[model samples]
Target: MKTYFALIFSLFIAATAFAQNDTTQKIVEGRKNSPDQEKKPYVILISADGFRYDYAEKYKATHLLALSSSGVSASSMIPSYPSVTFPNHYTLVTGLYPSHTGLVNNSFFDRNLKESYSMGNKTKVADPKWYGGTPLWVLAEQQHLLAASFYWVASEAPIKDTRPTYYYIYNDKISIHNRIEAVVAWLKLPAESRPHFITFYLPQVDHAGHLYGPDAPETEKQVHFVDSAVYELTKAVTTTGLNVNYVFVSDHGMTKIDREHTISKPAAIDTSKFIVSGDDILVQLYAKDRKDIQETYQQLKKEAVDYKVYLKENMPTNLHYGTSDDWHNRIGDILLIPNWPKVFNMYGRKQLNPGTHGFDPYAVMDMHATFYAWGPAFKSHLKIPEFQNVNIYPLITAILGLNYTEKIDGTKQLAQEVLK
Candidate 1:
């Protein structure tokens, strides 16, 4: 009986030791497969323009919701001040605010260029001088990593005297399927030719939102359509058998607007005293001289319009804008941001659509965007609070294992919470 008891005890100890060894092995293997351990990590950043943060809860985006549930998702991503398309998109890749980046608005007058740069002006859009800060693709090239882009804003311009290894100018005519196929083709390139980083921009959702409002059936349909395209793209990438980190984001959200809520300009002030820029939501007024600036400021402040006007010096501290000299030159002498639902109608233009943005980022949730990340780099089943869009730049650089030397506004610590 004693001998049998001893033998049983010995077997129990052996089993415990084996279990300990297995656990240690797993820990080692996990560390080995971690993002930091990978020599060449592939990252795909997709931007679905105007995808609202709440869309994940409102729409039946099965694939996107699955990604959010299985991976790391934020409640929302806050855009920089003057939450508009061009400014926020550039901010995401550059880690700089609109004012610092010099792309303050979709359209602005550059005193240096002596020309008004509008989204419709392809020549100015392609001009490198209009863009400020080094874009991610340029950073990737500096690190000797191959990069590619598909119709992302500023990708057409040669930023920092460098363009992506593979890129196409903005083309709305291209079908979504073709865009997905093109990206997949780039991924299928031989190991030596494949780009280490890639970016894709889908504008259909934003277009639908602008034309048919966020609550419209067309917008919901577009959400599903974009979700389907992303699902297909994921399947294609999986077929390639490459380990890719995927980041899905949007520039800003959309909100309903109507002509009834318009705030007409006061007749006391002359419109010609300053060159007005920006859209109806956020209006920028640039004056020719200090006297014009003071007159415009006083007249705008005295007006009973449903908007708050500020001089460049007294702008909101939270905006983190107007600090750079380039920004000072580009930003307006008098800034006007209308109250929510009350768009500033400088010329009383007919309301073409029921949607717009560029409201106070804190006051209106419609200005917020979506942020979802998944891959070997991110923790699974994680949900984080809303964060600023600027942080995305540092997070991406970290995932790529590239050393970032620029003095960017985003910090890697803000993004490390989602990493495993």
Candidate 2:
């Protein structure tokens, strides 16, 4: 009985240790970089979620400023409309607009599947059928190039029936030192087995922004943390004696919201008639019956005071959203977009976060994200004008010499401008 109790205690301790620092690497075996792929240069595609275009300047992120100044920097990279996390992160990898990729918002309902997807729902996030477009990792793996992801939006899913050759399920359990060490280890592998394309993500800045407003010193501290972390990762990579390119981007920017006077559900729309999805910045109404869309839209428009209401059909074409652009039909029928700074609190049941995103990136400049690239694959001391985020797909593919035939929205113009 004492031995059995000891075994139980040991199991509990083992589980606790695993929970603290989950360094489990998921690998797809029986994959190798071809001779041609092995010759290709390396790319460490990094996304700093919610790192705005100006944060490095505003916060004096020394490492990032110096690193990007040496290579290529964008004035601002325009996130696709409803500039939010899940959608834009997925957009960065797939090079498709949220409408085209079917990840319309961080949380949205799919009328056809009679299901919904949310960033918090691990099951929905991991299911491959919900994703659309050929992600860059998939594009690389399909062409016999090995790829890896430290953490990415859909990297956990078997999208296109192919996961990255090496990846980690999204988690914050690992320390920055461990993450940097992992990247260095991946690079140090034999040429044929090493990943030519790697992805890394940092959520520190975004988390700080959301918790403490963008202008807070607390947020600035996180900015510096990311700055130091990236510098460390790159510094570690230098030890491997391999040329590893890096493109640092963000899913979207952050903005302080008016949390005091949050918008409430309009009395004009009956909850029984429509299913609600979305949050403070964007509110989407999915009609229970097809007949409810028009009436609900008209009523919401009449009642909307601080927000704009539009039928999915009438949404601005520039957003690349609406009836015509709804490739997967995941977009809401009646959409409500709160004007800048105003956010919905639904029934006023809960207080709101001081900072938020998911606004129109063009209309609200605060929603624009960052883009910085460096290493042997890119031009030096070059700064480009603001470009749409979709163009990033072609840029990385161009760097890694990965050919993609899919007619994605991103063009090769940025690649031609930035690469050697």
Candidate 3:
């Protein structure tokens, strides 16, 4: 009887131990399959510069259309006021307007730095002081995710004192095929070294749009070329067997401009009294003295009949400009915005491009850009109405599951309808 009881107790202990080990193994597997422990999702943001919203409809871009059919698309992506390149690109990444980003235009004078920042000025372009708000890549790195960029605006700059995990300085000479291959190679990196967020920029579309009118055959050819490149990139990424969420966007669209509609500076206004910035569509006049402010405003108001002039404090509320002191210092004492197809000149002008942007976003359909997203995270066959470009930053962060606490103007609500 004693031997029987001892044997039974030993058997009970063995059974309990086996059950506990089985439960432990199940818990480990559960954690391994948890949403947080699974392979992290990847996001690839591609920008085909000057890719107007209508291009997908007008051109033979079967790839883009197919992607749109499979994912979410917007009728148009409304650009921030000034509807230019650098400002809108930075806005898309930082979720801040040009006024807040301190990149009011493609080229602006930094009063504090006492230096001019132009697209052509490589040194100044790489300087971090010129950029404001936290860039997407910098935010990603802070959360232990890696980021990479290829020829993105302000990507070369060490924004917020940190650069992307991998980046390339702007190099127009690099062929599109080479750029695509480089991106593929980056994607093929070891899982430990791979980047979670990647940015690719293609400027050929914008260049073609500037050299020729938006509807010209040359522009159409370039658009097709861009489409083909994008298709190749998608194919390459798919071959890697990695799940990637792709987002295609453009900074702004191009509008036809004519040489016949030129508005030169009025002779009454002294050129030396103020410094002016901006191109034909928008002119920013900075008075040298406080007294010249009213004079410049009155002169521009009286002489420039084709353009609308406004004092800095009285800028249009819809523009979301002139509120920040940093932007105010960069802007002019008097703002001049021309009517459609009209050009304003501060100096003797040369031949202008057949197409250009920087028009008021609300007034011109041509100023609207493109937005399309495709991936597991997005709903298929979803079409959303046009929303501000500022909202893209929040949508991207949300998709990456990043914790963002900045006071950004963007909201995920603008893009929530497209998410699964």
Candidate 4:
């Protein structure tokens, strides 16, 4: 009886330890902002995933619209090609296109790593090796400026051997009130330990978008949810008297797909000859045999319907994807980007979710995401034209007064246009 009780207690303790790991924030020890760095301005970069470009006006996201109108608002922000959640969010911070960043898709096979990266896989999500480029948080930390994340893609991973000084592993269990409280606490920290750069993410809009089509009332409800929550967030922070800068954006927009007319996985694909990753909107096939690439590309092209097939080298150059820009070689050998509203039902489900994104933003307006900014760092009442998401990296670095000379796809033009 005693032995059994001891074993049960040990198992319980181990389980409790595992659960506790993700439920709280992780702070890096022995890190502090320099006196000069601590004096830098504060920025809370917020992403409401899948919040469409027109959502503020269309859905009446009042706080966001009003805030942006007071500062700067863009017509729309063009997401990197194949606009999707993971790649574009990473792009927003790194100033690199998806192909160059080694995060080519939400789920993609890395040829060199000989492995797959999927958002669902916790182990891969936390692995530093899978991430490339110096994310904004990492850049700030290296320069001795503290950073924090309420949540953002890859913020958990210690890319470049550094993560935000204060961050929590992704968890939906925490309530909005708790999250807001945490940020308030961080702002109240002693100057040396306070964070000047922070990332905040809200997933409710994206969740509703994927489950209920963008046009559905459920999605609208979530949009309102986001609007309310952000209002609360800003209001709470206002008490801190820090004059924090705010830049609100999203990874991609949501589009309703024709579920009744979904495409099937091409019969031409032979699993033995390739490894397939990615989803319906953008299908990526990683070739097992180098010689197999061209042959498969031709075969896919011949049978293609409602989709455009391309050899990786032949993808549209304007996308900044494929051969030359594929510096990390993570893009697949063949690509299949389907026409809008005609998604590939690869998993053989009865149908796909009513709404999804990952289309070329230029071709489908719905693929365009949001961009709005206010607070001390920006010019007031300015509206700019559509710009690529990659430019966000430099815009942020410029605001924080952090310097970098690394060649990135984004231009300094955006900073010149909007900054005060």
Candidate 5:
């Protein structure tokens, strides 16, 4: 009898020790989610670049559509002015307008650095140092949470002491499969170190759309490619038995433009009079000689019959551009916006080939973007009436429980709409 009793007590003690250790591990790893975490809340922000909302429905992305049918969905998302990828992505992460985030264009003169910064140059890319605002990933790290990014806006750039725990260098050529692989690798890490926040970017949809129109069959197929990748990623994450959340978003919608639709300065103006900055819909004209401002302005105005020409002081206030000192100097003295299909690039002898963005965001062809949410954290079967790309930042920060108090131009939060 005594021996049997001893064995039973020993087993009980061992089981208690194991349970205690498990609880301690959960706390140490920061995975001890609250009672409210039953939804298996985790976030995966996926960027499909120039995907349009209607295509998402028309093509019947069963997986993505299920997310909308089960969780919150939006008919369309509005993009900020000069809606290029860099600016729009920055806005998504920082909750700031292009002017506030200092990414007004993909390629712009950084007066402070006395050098031009562009999306192509990794060295000159925007970072926490140059950005006046904080990205959600930085905030996540500050809160002792592990954040990983496969490929996201400015993820490669070193931010003030806060870098994603894991990140891949931004590559325009990286296939959808590789991006999914990288994300799965990070999630499969030791449970204690698994990322609490993850961001994945698929550039093919946007890349192909820029070369073709967003509605082109090629672009639609590209969207399907990304959709397939997302479906696979979701399955992988769920199989790991970790609670996760997913967000599908695009930087901006796309528009079709060709050479026949292009406009430029009349042949009479001296070609060498100004430095030409290439923005498809918006033209930035820098005077080669400051003394010619008045004459150049008059000449540009005379030829600007097809587009809207605005002096720096008289620029549209609603566009949320041109008011800041940094923006004023970086932008040309005169800004020109073209009508749809009608676009403009710096008019030199060089032949311009290809479609582009950086147009007004409210045009009939430009107003709508795409957004979708899935997993347990989102509000089920809800539709958000109106939202912007900048609203994404607040949603990310809130989901990660990061402490950020900076005043971003975009303060709206989608948590209530997306979270049950």
Candidate 6:
């Protein structure tokens, strides 16, 4: 009886030690996979343009909701100032606000370059010379990790002196599902060349939101469709049993700007004198031909009350915008910010709906976007109330275990919750 009791007591002590070690081991593993934990970790960053936080709760988004429930979530992710698509999206990868990033407005003229940058075409879309600073994909390559982009601006920029290990040029014909298919295919590549970093951009939501308000049934349908695509991608990847980190985000929310209160062209200045960048809400006033800058400045200033006007030299300082040599290359000569309940539309565009973005980011309309993270590297059911989309750079850099030198505009790593 004495021997039996001694043996049982010994067994209990051994089991307790193992249990304690098990808990510690999980923590150690968690830390090992944290964003800053590894130098070459697999990661995926998805941009569902115009995705709103409320939509997540209002709609049946099993995949996205699962990601939020199992990982981290925020009520809304605010965008940088001048919350247009390209600028906000660029901010995400570069970790800099639009003002600092030089994408101040959606459509602006490059005085030095003698051209304009718009969302259309390869020349405007893929020009590396126009882009500034280092992006996430370029940084990933520096650290020896393969980075890939399905179709995001500046993705094809020749800044890095070499292309991503795997990349696809922007093609509108490629359906959202096809893009996700390509991403999954890349993930299944041979282990030696499998992409460790990936960024996916979906235009469906943004398109629908632009055509219809966020609450419109068509836009709601688009939200569901993209959510389903996300589900398919997530399901496919997890089935492979490969460890991965994922983040779903948006550059900015959509607001239905009222189409009234437009500023008419001054009769004093020839309407043909300037090449307008945007129609009504935002307009880049540029010289259509050589014109007197002083005279033009005065004409615009005299009529400023009708609009929120800013000369290149006097754009709102709060925006962190400036007309530096590089910026002047992309900054318009003058900017017109229309008042509330009013939107701008250029006279020539064939846009069916008269709605658009390219306005202040602080307004209630443009402030909210989306931010959520999931996978093996995140804390479950965590909520980060305040975070910037720009922080996404550092987060992705950490996930892929790469070194990013740029002082990130938003660099707060979701580190606390990510560790066990």
Which runs in model 2 stand beyond 4 Å of their true positions? 1-22
Count clashing residue pairs in model 4. 0
Model 4, 1-420: lDDT tens digits are 999999999997886556445768899999999999978999999999999998888888888888899999999999998798899999999999988888888998988879889987766888898877899999999999999998888998889889899999887888999999999999999999999999999999999999998989899899999899888989999999899999999999999999998889998888999999889899889988999988888888899999999888888899988799888888988988889989998889985789899999889999999999999989999999999999999999999999887778889899999999
lDDT for model 1: 0.81
Residue-level lDDT of model 3, residues 136-166, one tens digit each, is 8888877767788876889878787778877
Q: Note the Cα lDDT for every prediction shown.
A: 0.81, 0.91, 0.81, 0.91, 0.70, 0.69
User: Which ranges of candidate 6 are over 4 A from the true structure?
Assistant: 1-39, 175-177, 266-275, 287-298, 304-306, 324-328, 348-355, 413-420
How many pairs of residues collide in each model?
Answer: 0, 0, 0, 0, 4, 9
Model 3 vs. true fold: TM: 0.89
Q: What is the TM-score of each candidate against the true structure?
A: 0.89, 0.95, 0.89, 0.95, 0.83, 0.81
Residue pairs whose backbone atoms clash in candidate 5: 42-245, 378-418, 379-418, 379-419
Off by over 4 Å in 5: 1-41, 126-129, 172-175, 266-273, 287-291, 324-329, 345-355
Model 1 pairs in collision: none
Segments of candidate 3 deviating more than 4 angstroms = 1-38, 324-328
* Candidate achieving the largest lDDT: 2
Q: In model 2, which range of ten residues has the least summed lDDT?
A: 14-23
Model 3 Cα shift for residue 311 (angstroms): 1.0
Task: Name the runs in model 4 displaced over 4 angstroms.
Answer: 1-21
Give, for candidate 3, the lowest lDDT window spanning 10 residues. 23-32
Q: What is the C-alpha RMSD of each candidate to the true structure, in Å?
A: 20.1, 4.3, 18.5, 3.4, 14.9, 18.7
How should the candidates be ordered by TM-score, best one leading?
4, 2, 3, 1, 5, 6
How well does candidate 4 match the true structure, expressed as C-alpha RMSD? 3.4
Score candidate 3 by lDDT: 0.81
